[model samples]
Target: MQPMALWKRVLILLVCLWGIAAAMPNLFYAKVEAHNDAVAAIEAAGGTATAEQEAARAEWPDFLPSALVNLGLDLRGGAHLLAEVQVEDVYKSRLDALWPEVRDAMRDLRDQVGAVRRAPSPDGILRVTISNPDGMTAALEAVRALGSSVVTLTGVGQSTLEVTAEGNDIVVQLSEAEKQATDDRTIQQSLEIIRRRVDEVGTREPTIQRQGEDRVLIQVPGIGSASELKALIGTTAKLTFNAVVSRTNDAGADPGPRNLILPSMNEDGVYYIVEATPVVSGEELVDAQPAFDQNNRPAVNFRFDTTGARKFGDYTAANIGAPFAIVLDNEVISAPVIQSHIPGGSGIITGSFSVEESTQLAVLLRAGALPAEMRFLEERTIGPELGADSIDAGRIAALVAMGAVGLFMIASYGLYGTFAVIALMVNMALIFGIMSAIGGTLTLPGIGGIVLTIGMAVDANVLVFERIREELRSQKNPFRAVEIGYERAMSAIVDANVTTMISAATLFILGAGPVRGFAVTLGIGVVTSVFTALLVTRAIIEIWFRISRPKSIVV
Candidate 1:
């Protein structure tokens, strides 16, 4: 066989070195992970680091590659939660918000419809009554004008609202198509908000994805507990600036027809009755940051977008000396009298809040409100101890498999078996290197795939060696026998690998979570083994033959 080209030999050497270097950080996983976290924290702190953070950062070499293969929830152990989004709540909120527009439309036609007032209605319907029955036609036409075209793929041609006259009352509700579209939008918004909240905490490899029509599955790796995860995401954080109606200490006070009662967040046994419609809602808030108020107390400073700024400016300008409540999730956080026309759209919220609470509230507000409420269906916390045990078991299994394979190969072919063993080690290193480069997560099944790869890595060598034995029996030269052996075994090796690659691809596409992790390692191992087992072993044998120049050899 012709000697391997110098370029090819150098390329092989470079690839092997790269794999080993990439895999080296994983051996000191905890130290490197701490270093990464410390670096991230320092960067977030604007280059200011605590003594502990500086110590952690110094533990690992700065010049070494730090990218590591992520460990999945099953291996890292964190929190899992399945939540069902209350899409109907958004339907009610959207419908309730329509009352202002409807009232405004009919008010412009007061000469025809007379005085208009909102009537008591259910969650998803808005009913308005007028004094004059003869104005029913005018009212219907005015309300219908408020309806807009539904902007969705399936509801493009449909109107967002259905307006009808029931006696002297003008009733309105979302159309069927609009309801579907709203449900989709609400679920999507909730998913994004939850993802933002989780990412804000710097947890790694979180799986925040929609499950079905209204369910979301959340798995956050490296979080403390399920309760902690739920606390972080479960808070609706719905903020509104409502007109203050009345205040009371009674637990069961009756609010007026268009007013609602909410308990005070700062005061015990206190309540406030606020108007249903908000002057501005949290949806228009563009930014919120934790800060100190005039009293040096923890507060959240907020800035509004252009639309919110105009509304806020007009309301504060008109309602000077009148108390307007800042409500969060139906609770009155504060009721402050408007001192002046708070013009710049920037305001501060002061309450009895600790620094930690204020910071978390700022994060939640910045992430934006969840369009609808979420009821958690399930909550589970996997302990890191269990993950440690799994990782240890996987490590031991991989080491045992490698050792057993190496011993078996060495006993079988003597010198060439040693070559196979060396190539097998390189194969494992290359698998890890590929995973690290791609930021792949490793699970228990992935470890199993790695162990299985140990066996498969030597299969090609076994086939070629058997073929070489056959050629030797027929009295061929050593070099010629080795050449024919690899050539004859190439077809079987290719067929086996082709089928395996197909299986790995299928699993990766169809499977979720840990199954996909298994597929990733198996697929990567298949490729690396081909390089190390068939090609690298051949290269090693070639160098051995060139050095010895043996004319006769024992198989």
Candidate 2:
């Protein structure tokens, strides 16, 4: 309205554009070189890389930031996994950490409750068969006395009280708040551990988010097989060091065969036993790389931190002839004997490893260690065929919608409609540039939302242009009319966009996956459209009025 503020508006717009570009590099332009490198690596692996990857490799320029807006598996035709961690493993970890107290508590509960009954279910959830439910309350008090923490006490059958761990695997009595705290912690820790594992596998852009309590949603765009992914993440990566039972110690031992340390077991009874306590755990290892053994076989070479190296050297020197097992997720990969003491704190793990298997083992060993053992729950695969169809349909739908909206605006508003069309183009450019800068995935649903946003963006300009016509009818000059129209229509435009933005925000917070993606494009469109219409379009109109300086304002 104030002479279109050309220089000021352009400067502000540039600043906004630059900021978006800095924050997100995915939407506006694709980075070519890194994309090409990814293609080359995959091709070198004898895998079928995508056409886009080939194009990127051939044409990608240098100097783009490493970050890219990665498409979701639904759009890119990749792998999806839903993993549920073993709550029992979580409980066991806690119990093992607090063994002295937990063992004592369970023993005290058994003795105090007396007459313990087995749960009807096959899962072996034990219950106390009390003479009176009220009498069992005293025994519960004794269990609570083992620790001051709250305990959960549930009545199963008439005289049975079901006592179990409140979180993951460890059952303990806790208040509502404590239960919530435990749930929060497990989810948080699991997310971190999963992130570390997934990163090790070298996915382009993987997403690992917590779903409802106790479940995690993992999406890897370029990954093909769900089973391989499940194998990669289902491991809890729990490593323990235990003293080995010697042959002499097994004979009439006071501590019953010197404390038989059982290895971790899979559902099918597959288990591994570490013959000796690990002088240094996987946590101490800083890096792992695939290498070749003396026989040119695939092997994983690992290096430990200073402390780990020192401990390893000391332990190997002390136990020169004994065998130490290389265990993973409770299964032994290999158990090589300490032929001679090596003090470097670096060693190679040689096994029956293929090239891929060697790489995977190196990844796992390098990903630090998992807090607890995990298990696979569910998985799904979306083929490239479906993804291609979605892209084509989405593109056709967007073109049709934009063409229809453009025709309607020009038909209704005549000459003024032409200006509204120009504003629409600017609005679109800004949206795309912003999206590219942010690197958000452009899904089919996201495209639908953007089309809807374009219509809403045009609505604001239409309202202002119509208001200007009304002012001209009231015998005002074109300049005066444009100013008044902008002033009069500003409130309505603000109210409309604000309400829509609030709704979009609400959807974003509550929705999951695709729904959230839809909300994201919708919300971004609203803010950018508002800026283009209220400032950019207004400036263009006012500047035209100043130059023309027409006597009679055409309606």
Candidate 3:
């Protein structure tokens, strides 16, 4: 056989060496992980590493690729929560907000509509009664004018609100298109907020995804329990600044029209009557951090965005000595009197909170509030012991498969079979290297993929070796037989691997979770196996033949 090109051989060698280097860090996972963490800590602190951290960093060389394949939740253990967003709650808030607008609009045409009064209605519905029943058509037209087009791709040209007149009552509710849009926004915002919350705790690769229209699925690896995960994300954190009109200890106090009575967070049973319209919403907050109050108590310091800052500065300037309620999730956190004209839109919130609670509140503020409340429908905690057992089982299965394959290959075709076995090992290394490079997660099914790949890795080699035996029978020349064998078997090897790769790709696109993990390993294995079988084994055989200069080769 003709020798391989020098550049081609060098390229192949370099690739193999790179794969080996990339895969090396997994052998010392804990040490490499510590080095990476130390580097991150030093960068975050803007300072030098400690002596222990320095030692840890030195355990892994900086020049080589140090990425390791992330382990999946099934392998690492974690908390899982399936939550459903209360999207209808947003509708109620939306209608409540619209009351002021509707009332103002009706007031403008008081002569035509007569007296306008807000009538109690179910959630998501707004009912306004007019004294004159004959003028309901004109009133409906005026209210309908308030309906704006829904701002969504599927809701283009559709009104955000529906207006109808029943006798003297004008009924208002969100349009179907608007409801769909709101649901979409709620789920997306919930997912993002959950992600931010989980990421704040420095958990690795926590999965927070929208399950359906109103449901979210959260899986946080390394969390102690589902309850812990819930505690982190369950709070609505709906912080708002409302102007306080009166203070009361009565739970059933009447705050009059367009006002609400909310219970205090620190003082039990004490409530405050505040305006429904917020001066600044939590959505306007740009940043928040855990801080200490002047009294040395834990607190959360927050800064608002430009618009919010201007609005807050103007409001405080106009209402000095007036109390404004800091509300969170319908509860009054505090009703502090504005002592002076506060500017710059930065403030500290002090309540009866512990250090941990303050820190969590700060995290929530930074992440922003969930659009609406979420009800956790399902919760689960997977123990680390179960994950460890799964890892052990998968590891044992893979090792046993590798050993059996290696032994079978060696017994079947002698030195040539040993070459195939070596190529198989290289194939495994390349698979892991690629996975590590891409930050792929390894699930239990992924280990099964690797084991299956071990058995299949040598199929191309076996085909070539069998063809070589046939050629040897006909030609009786080792060099010519090897060349002809590889050439003739190339088409079959390519066809087999390509078909399998297509299957793996389909699995990846159509599957989720463990199936996706299986697809990833399988797809990677197919590519690496083909490379090792065609290049590595051939290189080994050609080199052996060149050194031995055999006249005839054994089958």
Candidate 4:
């Protein structure tokens, strides 16, 4: 009757609609490719699902809510993925960082001794021949940081002196093992990272979780394919720049004395040539997009920060004759010569990469490099068939719960049962709205919580209804009965829902993955149920009274 009341009704409807819209994508495959697949399936199936099948489907929960929000994987088919992040490569990365120091130490030892040659040994040993016994002792001291040991010596007192050194090979081996362990830990850290990224990107109800030591399990409901998920997680995008090995005519010419710069390495026993000095680190790039160059070849367009751009320009200018290497995850992708300066801070990397490869690279870069390099320890795919079955089971459980609650409300209460049903509907709508608002994932447990909340919602309504009947039986006027019912029952409903809310909050705070998902939906349901039962349902009863000014109320 009043403008304010009309607006309240309108607000409730709009919020319910909003929740459904927000959840639609996660509940249904709204992507173009999925649409095409559904269309094809429909055409192949002779234009419709069989009447028996359609009837069975209706008996099950209908996924289409407002023609947008669809059921989650527990009601539809989807894929799951489990993969581990690789950590061995991170150790190699640390080794790469130590190259400058390793090279410098090698040269110092070589000069002090007769000549030092890199030997293929597990301990990273360098064989050195000393001109004298004193020099041999000096060379060993110079290489102390290398963890070397003087293995053999000959002509201790003679003019010609030789000493073989083997450092702490055991320590180095342990270091490699530790690196692997660190990589494993990175996978653990990455679980949160992947979860945040996926959730923010609006992948509804995705379960990104840690599996034993190094593995992660991700289940995305209604996301029926794992191709994108695989591409997102299985990436070892360790990017670095190295100076190209010198191929000048004076190859052996000593790199002129300059304050020790990164690109400079000791000339002796440094086997890997300096490919190129990286001017711009991958860290500077904020975003990457897949694109094709003028040649229509797959490439990634990258943008760098101001600092990166400046450094890149300087390196290209200084190394005009040298080629700079673009290394991705320690593998050399390109060795383009610094023919000219590239100062714009943005450039395309041209390689023989396929469109998919290029896109994958772009995604990895944009997601940012892992704190440490990682390796894929394992990978497995979950078929949609299993997800579909789970969906069916969950739907049946929810239906049974709803049916039981509905029957109990109608049979236990007389005219008041109708009001309780209306409140239950609003409660369901509010739960969906809240989930959509926060993008909470609806797991099977989450479905159970929703169903449980429906019964709880009716319980609140029944409390008020019973209070109304008491007031009416006492010979109170219809309006007075309605007012007294809400007033008396409000305190009880608040006490019950508040205690449940506290428990839900505790669960959410202590839990992870699916447990957290369940907690979120449960907490939201409790709040929404209370509001719908007390406020919306009360409003509906008031509206009914205004329409029919009867001497006696239905209750």
| RMSD of candidate 3 to true structure, Å | 3.4
Residue 355 lDDT in candidate 2: 94
RMSD of each: 3.6, 8.2, 3.4, 11.1
- Give the candidate order by descending TM-score: 3, 1, 2, 4
TM-score of each: 0.85, 0.70, 0.87, 0.70
Instruction: Give candidate 3's whole-model lDDT.
Output: 0.89
Residue 439 Cα positional deviation in candidate 2, in Å, after optimal superposition = 2.3
Q: Write the per-residue lDDT of candidate 1 for residues 72-132, one digit (tens) a residue.
A: 7878899999999999898798878888888889878899988899888899998999999
- In angstroms, how far off is 28's CA in candidate 1? 3.1
Candidate 2 per-residue lDDT over residues 1-555, each given as its tens digit? 346456886885684555455444443234543564666677776887677666665554445433444565666777788877554554434433433454455454554444433222212232223333433565555544554433323311122122443211333433344444456667777788677888766665466888787788887776777876777777656543333443221323343411433432222333333343345678788888999999999998988889988988888889888877666655556656788887888988877789998887777677756655565678887787787687678768877888898899889877667777777776766666666557666666778788898899889988888898899889887778988998999999999999999988998898766777788889989997788777777766666777887776554
Comparing 1 and 3 by TM-score, which wins? 3
Quote the positional error of residue 213 for candidate 2 in Å.
5.1
Q: What do the candidate models score in CA lDDT, each in turn? A: 0.91, 0.66, 0.89, 0.63
Q: List the residue pairs that clash in candidate 3.
A: none
Query: How well does candidate 4 match the true structure, expressed as C-alpha RMSD?
Result: 11.1
Best TM-score goes to which candidate?
A: 3
Error of 1 at 284 (Å): 2.3
